[model samples]
Target: MTKLMKAVVVPAVKAAWEVRQRPVPEPGPGEVLVRVHACGICGTDLWMAHGVLSFREFPLLMGHEGVGEVVALGAGVTERKIGDRVGLPMMQKRCGACGFCREEHPDSFVTAGNCAGPTLTGVNVDGALAEYAVAGVGGTVLLPNGISYEDAAPTVCAGYTTWAGIRRADARPGARVAVVGLGGIGHFAIQFARAAGYHVIAVTRPGKHELARELGAADVVTDGAVLKEIGGADVVLHTSSSHAAAIDAMTGLRPWGKLVLMGLSEDEMILPALSLTTHSHQIIGSAHNGLEYLAEALDIVARGQVRPMIELFPLERADEAYRKVADGEVRFKAVITL
Candidate 1:
């Protein structure tokens, strides 16, 4: 009993996406059909479209982040039912039986698409740009007060990235924290740093200094070197993927400071070997987090501590939204509404 629904499809790599009517998917055992409320235009999505990343097949329904309502429930699912507002993040499902899952290594992401899950969704699965999507019950997050589905949508990825950055820092009260690139990840990083009780310094592109300051940077500086001049901090989180920015950020650290790379960077990163070989600095690549951090992110947003900036667009207008994100026309995050 497949119903008809509208979805965005990329028929091939490096191909333009087109809107198509797809059959509304039914939930299998342990699955649920979500009526997408909003889907965010992420950097990874842009990269995938541009061939910076590729896997599986094209002509696939692709969406990784969205806020939706649980319109149908599969067998064995009891906690959620029809009309439950929820979020489906990038990690649709991780293998609970994997060693990584056992060790609770947040980096051990074993998704079904990597397994046998619907690769036709977003990036190999039918994603949120569609009127309806099928997702595992495990990865769906129920939205709480203080977050509209529109606002909560970006947090599915952006918020989690910032949370992972903060966790990597082992941030404590009064620690000096610097966040580079105040875009989606950067904006949330500042708020997370504040919540962690750190002295927040924002580093962004020269064009975003004013925006950075407004977001709670004690001050915003385009020059990362000035970080060392001010004696630096215990943690510097990199949310921008620019290689030059990463290099400059390394030099800004105080001795033994931590640099957590959290953003999407397609560019091959080159760092000064001396920084790692000579100094006792901690440099960690912050990957997307597990359910633990996802819950934490939801909690923060529910409590109104971390708010994701989002713009809404009809799902049909996703290409326009993508162009805006790529062209830097969107000030914060842009979401496609179904």
Candidate 2:
């Protein structure tokens, strides 16, 4: 017999969310059924709801950052079992046949390299806004025993994305990392860089210095003055959604330094030719987490090296939660709890 569950559904772009009863999804081969405890409200959710990013399927279920306990397992799934806590991040599933999934060594990083096809949970298909959600076994990670569902929810996407940027920068001990923007992603970036032994320099609009410092940032600066004080930074994790802010961050990077853009923007950045050619600076764009990266993030949270700050909203108040995130009123991240 098919089981039914209540889920938040959007009939169309710019439509009001409605609570609808949908048939509980059964796990297919290589997948697992998760009884969702919490799901996060992200900027991407807003973009999808507002029709900014065109993955435009109507009557959609949206939520990529989800944490839950496994309730059932599909055939051939030996990695996890019922009652295990798991996380479903945005990069939900990848084809093992792709170059990104095939590597010569296990230590090599997994990334969405040049491959065009991948299954995204919220954007491409149904996601975790429901009482039950499905995730690929390979893409799911077991949450740390110490982290609660509310804290673990945002880490699936918001936390992993920033951690990926910091890992790409390869910041060494004492190297300076200037984190631009102090939103959800930036908050985690600051802590992850610090945990990686980098001296974090947080940059945000004028009033966010204290908040940045509270997140374990070694120093806080409102603008590019951080460049002048330290002579330059070894790496810059640019998480600001503004195009101008993303481009300006390049000025703070020392010669051969890395600038990782973790923000979503549609604007074009006009870079000076001499600036790139002379300094040998690198600009890297990142999204979605690899299996190893997600596991590493969970481990970091487990060890108390970093923690995500989140506001909880009841599942039925998903609309209010989305509005709060859209209005920039959420302190850090917002989670829909069951």
Candidate 3:
């Protein structure tokens, strides 16, 4: 008999979701079947649900940050066993033949002709909101025994994204790093920046000062004025959705500083002419980290170097979790447990 599992499915654009049965997927070659323990809801999922992002199609299963146990393996899968805990990241298997992968370069995260392209899991395919999901074996990371599924789920996406930004900035110890926005990615940026030996300055709205400080920020400022008061930052991790806020964050960067943009904004970001030419400032956008980088991210979390604050909701309450995330009322991140 064919097995089935419950899943949260988006039937149409801006429509109500249905908790229905979906077939238990079998792993293909170079893939593995995972019994999902928890899946974190992301801002991209919210955008996909509401039809904001143009890449999404109707009748989609939305979730990317998944933590589970490998229950079955497909042909040629030797690295994973049936009971190992692993993370189902948004990135899939990488084609080993690509020049980017052949060089073992960290920055060559190719989406096309590799592992399911850049969309990867949850964007255009079946995702981990279900009880069981199939993922390419290459991108999944085995979790340490000390880390729980709930804790590891958010790090797969939120933590990795922020860590990628920090890596792109190439910050050194004692460098001043400013984190703009106090959402999920922002919180992780603050912690990762601090763990990397940089002084973390959190720039957020007025109400988030205490929470920012609690997350290892050396200083908390409400606006750009205070950022100017403390000289300037060597790097700025911009995770806010507002274009104006992102534009304002550039002023905080010192000469030759990097501003890494991790958030998705609909408005066009207009930059001043002299900012880049005179100061040699860089505006880099980072997304979709590769599996090699994700493994490093997991190591940091497994070692207790950083922690992801999350609120749990059962699979049946997935709608409520989506609503909470969309409303921007969530304290940090929200995870759905099976």
Give me candidate 2's TM-score against the actual structure: 0.92
Each candidate structure's TM-score, on Cα atoms with residue i matched to residue i, is 0.90, 0.92, 0.92
- Give residue 335's lDDT in candidate 1 (0 to 100): 87
lDDT by residue (170-256, candidate 3, tens digit) is: 877799999999988998889999988999999998799999999999999876667878877988888888767866877777889
Report the CA-based lDDT of candidate 2 relative to the real structure. 0.82
Q: Please give, for residues 1-338, the per-residue lDDT of candidate 1 as tens digits.
A: 45798888877776666889888888999999898888887887877777777765677566777888898899999979899998887776655565445554443233433333323236656678788888888768788766777778788878877887688678667988998887878898888788777889987777888877777788677767887777676788888867568668778887778889887776788777887667788878766656577668877887887777777788778778877887878867888887
lDDT of each: 0.76, 0.82, 0.83
lDDT: worst 10-residue window of model 3: 107-116
- In the order shown, the candidates' Cα RMSDs to the true structure are 2.7, 2.5, 2.5
Model 3 gets an lDDT of: 0.83
Error of 1 at 271 (Å): 2.6
Ranking by lDDT: 3, 2, 1
In model 2, state the lDDT of residue 164: 76
Query: Which scores better on TM-score, 1 or 3?
Result: 3
